[model samples]
Target: MSLRRWGAVLAGAALVAGAAVTPALAADPVAPKVTVAPATGLDPAGTKIVVKGTGFDPAANDGKGFGLRVGPAKADVRDRAGKDFQVSRLIKKGAVGSQIPLDDNGNWEYSVTVKAEYVASGTTYSAKKQPFSVFVFGWDTPVLTWDSTTPLKFTEAGDAATGLAWGLRHSWRNYVTRGGGTVTPSNGATLDTAAPNVEPYPYKWKYESSGEGTVSYTGQVTYTFEAHTIWDFTIADPRITFGGDGAGTLTAKVGYAFYGTKTAPEKVRTPSDVVLADLKLKAPAQAGDNVAVDIESAKLTAAGAAAFADFYKPGEALDTGRLVFPGKSGPAPTSSTVPTSSAPPTTTTSSSAPCVLTPDSVKQGNLLWGFKQSFRRYVGIGSGTSITASDGVEITDIDKIDGTGPPSGAYLWGFDSVQYKSATEFTTQFRGKVTFAYPAHSFELSIGRPKVVVAQGKGKLFADVELKTTSGAPSPPISQPGVELASLDLAAAKTTEGAGALSVAGIKVTLGNAEAFAKFYKVGEVLDEATVSLGASCAHLPGPGASGPGAGPGVSDDLVPDVKYRPDSALASTGADSGMWLLWGLVLVGAGLALVLVVRRRPAPGQRP
Candidate 1:
């Protein structure tokens, strides 16, 4: 549908009698071409939907162009109001904000308001209520040869109401008014004062229950009709209720009078609290007890029809109107949460102090890896990638790692979860997550809880890996639990033993799974090597990384722990080459031992005297 919005209406657009021409029936597929958008989800918000037409009869209807209208579904050429006097619109030049003049080619573009006025049909309520449609026909003579129809869908999806107004039934009210009868709202039923007086349900009433869905109103109206004493009837005190789930009822008091049928006296009866209509709520409000809405699709009940002397049949359409309800308020979810207490935990010393070092003992050290350099470059820290580490994990000394990884950076993840099965076999697991996020591409890779297992003289590195990427891109999202990421070649690895300590350094790292990269890298790729340094006090043994009574030379520590010597803390921070650091620490150790011996030998001053 070509539904383009038109801004300004043609100025001084006038409707005049046109030159006459004999009309001929338009044939099939020979109708005027027209288009409109959104044949559904319509409302009365004054929003205009533009309609454009071509090939309409310019010579028909005395050259005044065909009439444009919106009435019912199918927009039948034979019926203008489409079987019900409910709602329709006739397009007249500058008439009630609907106007568009046709050019000589029988083509024109116009805008029509979404709202439609219900035209009273007869003594009955509307026969057709839903699926309103749009149509085009002759203004005077009906030449329906050229035709196009579009069904409109209306919705009040998110609408709410607190107060309501309804005229009960459109045709009944019109019939009563034509017969000089009266309809009054006396008990709390008020008028809008500004709304059109012909509105069916003009009496406004306040909602009594705002229980979200189930609601009631606080007013009533009376319909009084007495036509020449024929059959005087009064339906009064009408009430409406919504059950929230599209089912409800309407109750009212009724009074009927059968003025003597030529032989019998007048028969008068009053029935109180009669079920007037069985309401079928149309498009009820969404869930929650915040606001009430319209009670739609109301129909006459059997008792109601009987009370009306069968003039109207049971299960017929009744007027359903909106009720403007106020929003309800209450305590929010967060405010009702329980509070937590604050305290500290107590720590107890292990009874097995000065213990022997074992392979099962927990150790402390760090591991380094660069991940992948190309992918890191694609999603740098600020551009598209953000990396975070958490869970008792501290990653520092980022630049120390060598080889392909993050640009100008690699990482060291310090782990305290270290255990050993034997002196030569040990396993160490990391504590935290390093998440690389690429928001622009909707891709993320998180590698966490890395565990390195060394057996005999060989080892492997594994970690929990979660990868998310578009399937349209390099790879699909996946969660690989305990993925073997790299193989550790410990052949050149150096394990140093100290006072109850063990340090394994310089283990080569080779890619074990290219899939861990989300297909960004391939297999057989070399990554940064790693080191493990740990120390713990044991039963009858000094912990690792300890210099016991000047007994040995230094160890490797470009701060990495190396075989033969363990460097002092001060020398470890120098960033010296690993081999050089090991050699220097040994020199310092020898010097320290000489000093200790000299001091011990010179301490016999009392014996010399």
Candidate 2:
């Protein structure tokens, strides 16, 4: 009977057999089902609008959720706009809002976006008119009317109002929207899309007058603009290669001019005359060729204005005709040539002349005759050497004597002293007399005479001597004063040795002073067992007793009278050297006895002999 209460319960139950009590079954809400994703668009401000709500009511509203309202379309009624177009709060499914802005007024239609509601416990579920669209944030200007039964026509009556303001400023700067600014157009209307890759004439917005107003043509009055896809149209400065049949055509006539109010009949613009009618361009067959285009541009036609007057006659004249297009002339650029080869006719042989050492053939009076020398100075081993001027040395006063240009030959002589005859080494054999003072000892000698540069050529006689002294006396542990000497190819004579004699085993001495002594010589030192010779002599001695030819009072009648060793009948017909033609006939008889002793001792040019 622990079920004591159970006993009572049974009694009560029996008594209440008439129990009709059964009430607790609620699950009937779910009225959500909302949706919005894009659906249409243009610029609903920030526009994100998601809203999705499927059978909502997860524990009804007590859970505090569901209720996304995105304005307008009667706010999706649920107790007459509860929470008035709420903006977002739906949670049993979805609700993304982006703040639901909306206001661009340039109205291109379609508006309403997601006005969902969900409520729950108290019951309410809505979502109607979720369309979309905002548009109008920039260029959309469209009012352009003019098309009265093909009325506007002006062949050229002074260019009918400048071709109706140049076809309405190039059709509103090429179909409007230059948002980044700049669009100028006037009588001469230009704006061919500023060139570069061109392409911009496909416009729209139709309806011309009959349905009453709206025009932006490129579709009629002869429209035609196929600039061959204009690849950066440059005309000159060397860039003239345009062919693929470049084209053009833009005629215009359009009519109607009323201006609002004739019971609403607006349609304006009736002026006319916009041509560019027949421009052709396809000319490059040579001036840099590259063709292609059998025909297109709707099969072209207008070959009018004499085809643009020979289309710029061979093209090249664009100081601003601003694109007239019509080129076609071709052929006239042929110049290639580059073959060259002709150089095999030289020859050149003539040799001879040149063994000349002249100063009037080695002068005489005061003696000059240089070449004919012999040297040997070393003072040892063979008993202090000996062999000074083995028959050479005579130069006493020969002044400027120069020569060159005789089949590779040169000689320059200037002297003032040379008596020579030294020998000391403690009197190895005793000898005295010695002058040698050229320019007081800074001597110089250069000779290279030996001609016949070709025909059996074999000539070479060289020498370059130098000697300096600050006060003479050198030959001991020599010290700096100078002493160069060379003899390179010294002797090879025989261009038929006319002037003959010269053989010291074909000379080749070389020993240009290496710092003068340097402890007894070492720089290119080559004595080669000493023994040298060079010839050619002359002597008359007796001339410095001055009396005329300005030999006195600071003399210098420009010191004339050398006549550069005269005698050159073309250098004596190329074989020269008959002793230089007997010293050129004794230097023309000593220049005719010194011009007859200066004209019997000048007393002319204002006297004074």
Candidate 3:
């Protein structure tokens, strides 16, 4: 019944030495003094409860410090009323002196006796006992944080927010490496499971004393693990590839949150709650691999808060969750549905017309071709001159086609050469006419290189004006010369044959007259160098940079639509094809079986059965 009696039996059985050495049956010495201190007094869950005692002999030499024998080291406060608490593990023992602390936990009063044997004049005497009462408070509230530098707190409820209240102990899962420990604080206060209405943690504070009887709660408490903004914002899925000289890296911020604790306290006091900012991701090349990041909790400054918002949504701060860093080419949800004004217009009409269909000639002077100079080359003049009765002499239906038109050196319809000579032939001066004459009206149009209109002479005769290329190049050639009435009536030019609608080439006129001075106009078009301007904040960050021939490495083939053939496979093909093939196979087998049956059933004329 007594621990000293139990210790003597244990020592005798545990040690090979006989009863003469066993420290039992000796007279009781002095009662050992015991003192206990809870590891975390505020919220003791896995917190230590150290029991310090003295009067045990330092050396009758067994073990120095002692472990918990009958009581539980961990308290379970899941059921506070019934007080269902159990001890979890024994603390490691160290050398014990006059004051040795035994680490254990429980609110109940228990006794721990340290034993030591002393031989006095060939006789042995038993040491004294050390007893203590453990008063563990506030072990019901669980702290579900991982190894982080800052403490994870809850969002404090204010006058506008709902007041804090305890609920039924909910079953919650904490993610950690198996055998990685977690501390539960509820059970430490009281293991009274039957008393469901009882407060898990005694509301010893004066603030909650008024609403004592009204608190009705039940159910298992669940706590989900989430990462913080610090770890979440850390870049992942970094992609690097060669540009001209250095490699470009593309990455986007990513994260997740679990719905357990809807709100938590903030360790750092700030003007606003920690939130995530929408991220401006930049990279030179396509990132093939996913970036791994760990988000930790931290306080944000004014600038940091703005930056965080760019990466995360409002109220959804980065919590403890594994995120696959978004790649440059990954599909992401549209952040905002409202389109921006600066957003490129899907269908744009330019103020100044692109290469126009005309019957008149371009007479811009001294054009330069393929020069390493300006951004755009000179396209031909708007020659598709329609003289409306209301808008006489005014070229009708000619306006700028913004963000669209013939790709470099392409004519008005993106087909046929705009240049009179080959791309390699370079000339300095030339006169070409893009003349479109109606039965009653005539328009003379001229275009010079880079993009210059030397003259657009139009009366009942010609559009007499000067034209110049955007780069002030020598005159480009005049193309597509024919009577407007005759060319518009051609059936071959207005036919739509295949999958897509009729293309620009479907409508065409004769490139009748094209003349360029061999020396003045340069041949062999050069890809112009484009200068892109970016905004201040987004300047250093990767803006819409030019990509090489293909998307960067690790580019998935699935994204690029297979335009080669069988494009209507989703609609054209179906289960019917497979079913038809199966039906044919089944019919063939049936025919073969029928033949076999016929052969077996055939009668023999010469022989009797």
TM-score of each: 0.30, 0.13, 0.14
Residue 14 in model 3: lDDT: 64
Per-residue lDDT over 1-609 for candidate 1, one digit per residue giving the tens place of the 0 to 100 score: 211211111111222234343334344443578877545544333223557787765665565345555544433334432333222333332121112456666677754334433432233222135545666666545665655676655545333334555556767866877788777766556643322223232555655543323334555556555564535465555555545445667777777666565235376666567888887655434313233345556788998888777878998887665544444322211112111212111111000112235654444455555454323433453343566656533333233223323332444454557777764788887666778776545567788878889898888889889987643333567798899988888887666665555556556777788766654444656555566655442211111222231122111111111122212332222221211101000112533311111011222332210
Report the CA-based lDDT of candidate 1 relative to the real structure.
0.50
Q: How many backbone clashes does candidate 3 have?
A: 129
In TM-score terms, candidate 1 sits at 0.30
lDDT of model number 2 = 0.22
- Residue range 423-506, candidate 3, lDDT tens digits: 111111222222222111122233221221111111010112222222212233334222111111123222211111111112
Give the distance in Å from residue 480's predicted Cα in candidate 2 to where it truly belongs: 14
Top-lDDT candidate index = 1
How displaced is residue 113 in candidate 1, in Å? Answer: 88
How does each model score on lDDT? 0.50, 0.22, 0.21
